[model samples]
Target: MRAAGRGGPVTRAAVLSAALAIVDRDGVEGLSMRRLAEAVGRDPMVIYRHVPNKAAVLDGVAEIVFAQLSVDVKDSDWTAQLRVIARDFRALALEHPHVVALLVTRPLATPLGQRPPAVVRPLEDILTLLTQAGFSGETALHIYRALFGFLYGHILNELQEVVERPEETDEVLRLGLHRLPVNEFPLLRELAPLLAHYDGAAELERGLDILLNGLAATL
Candidate 1:
């Protein structure tokens, strides 16, 4: 199973999917061209034929996760569409926590590699929403950046806690409430349990409402 040439013909998508599986199982550190080839049962050089190097392979993994976000933008209202997109994005990130670090660190640009077509429609949807909400192209771009940044930060923080303290729920709770002094931060202290709980979908909806509502006010 470890041998590179043990498998069959490999397509680019197959290779990327195999690489993502490796990351999902063992993390970004565990992924390599050779290992990916073995995972897909192909020649190591076969993977190189599809992606130039390990950097490209890592980028491909991110692209695969993005590809899973199959949002139907045309079928929904702008605000509802944005919330669904945000929720789906968060779900994908959480599902592939091992890729969270890389996804957060890299910008979605040509330098990282071209994103899959799956991202294009969702992105256009957000831009359309911003434009419909009275933002210029420049402002739409800023809003897109702000929304993604907030979602990514929130997901990454939650994932890091899950990874670093898998067996220590109390520790995770303590860390989450570290900023609060019990006496001075009574409300926060009282609500720490609720606050520490990370509900990606619910939070995405709430955040989207806040953003859209604020944008509506301005418009």
Candidate 2:
């Protein structure tokens, strides 16, 4: 047990900040109440004073990350606002790759009211944006769902892309696409060059263009 120091009391924000750091360096599994307390220079039991348990800590870490997400409910063009959000969300995910899992899955497990305020704030703001743009409450909810579903899928796919041999000059070798049997994956192997040099931002924009166009047709 270490002292939290004579500087100040152990605040929730400080605890969560330390937890986020541990996740950033070592992923979710690296965090524990004991480790968190140690990071903040407090006894393991003292950590319970700020957060109930590891689950709460996880929620807090996720909340801290999501608190940085900016949403403008007053943005006149809902489509353009969504575009900005999509790009910003992508950048946030990239900034904290380890926390992406939490951002995506935490809300699914927790009920809307039970989730952190910061986590739910964006949902309320987006709904407000669409409804003010003349969409019905139900329609606004659907639009929010549709947009986030696409964004979540896109971010997950982008993050999973791995270059087996990044230094390899040959595109096929760079992506390890050459290892596939020629007969079974001819097209995939042929597309090795494209796969090796993926542009996530461009892909996101193309997806948004298609999605927004199709969604607009529905209204």
Candidate 3:
């Protein structure tokens, strides 16, 4: 659906929002100026008036995603605040599974200085958290890399767990992992039951424990 207020002025927010929904229903490749125009009941030129090109639309989409993350680290325990933001990111990725790929891939193409303000806001907030916690500028940058890298990797890994049948009880059966020959994949076969019952939040928390604990000692 187009933004609820698309009937009014041709707002940039509406255009970006419609693009996000398009990306949600159809992957980013499916989003085009013409398609966005159709989604918002406007001409292609009209859509262009709001966003110069598809790349800008995507940048806006990224901003929309990163904006969901809490950057407010002031007057709170650092670890706890980071955990909240990490969990928020995990939820956002799951909600927009298709867009998650763009989240990582887009940054490689866009330079740091040229990135959208909304995209940079979270990093600045993290820097605030790290510096306030006694980390030097260089150390804070390293910590940001370590923390965000793990968070991104975790989201990818978690999403790769294919639940072929949600109602199914058997792990191997649920994921269709039983097709492998028992002799070659013996351990994996044996662990099927345990694997099927994977809890992403619990697993992420365990990883956070190790990562945050190790980082804390550096201060």
TM-scores, in order shown? 0.76, 0.93, 0.88
Per-prediction tally of clashes: 1, 0, 0
Query: Can you write out model 1's per-residue Cα lDDT over 109-215, one digit (the tens) per residue?
Result: 45423555554555676777667656698878776777787788778766665423335466335545555567777777676566566676676677777887785
Residue 194 in candidate 2 has what lDDT? 82
Q: Residues 103-141, candidate 2, lDDT per residue (tens digit)?
A: 998877898899989999999999999999999999899
lDDT of 2: 0.88
lDDT, candidate 3, 11-101, per-residue tens: 8888889999999999899999899888888878988888999988888888788778777768458888888888889899989988888
lDDT at residue 210 of model 3 (Cα atoms) = 89
- lDDT ranking, best first: 2, 3, 1
Candidate 1 wrong stretches, greater than 4 Å: 1-7, 71-76, 108-121, 132-135, 162-191
TM-score top scorer:
2
Worst 10 residues of 2 by lDDT: 1-10
Model 2 residue 36 CA deviation (Å) reads: 0.8
Q: List ranges where model 2 is wrong by over 4 Å.
A: 1-6
- By TM-score: ranked, best first: 2, 3, 1
lDDT, candidate 2, at 37: 82
The model with the greater TM-score, 2 or 3, is: 2
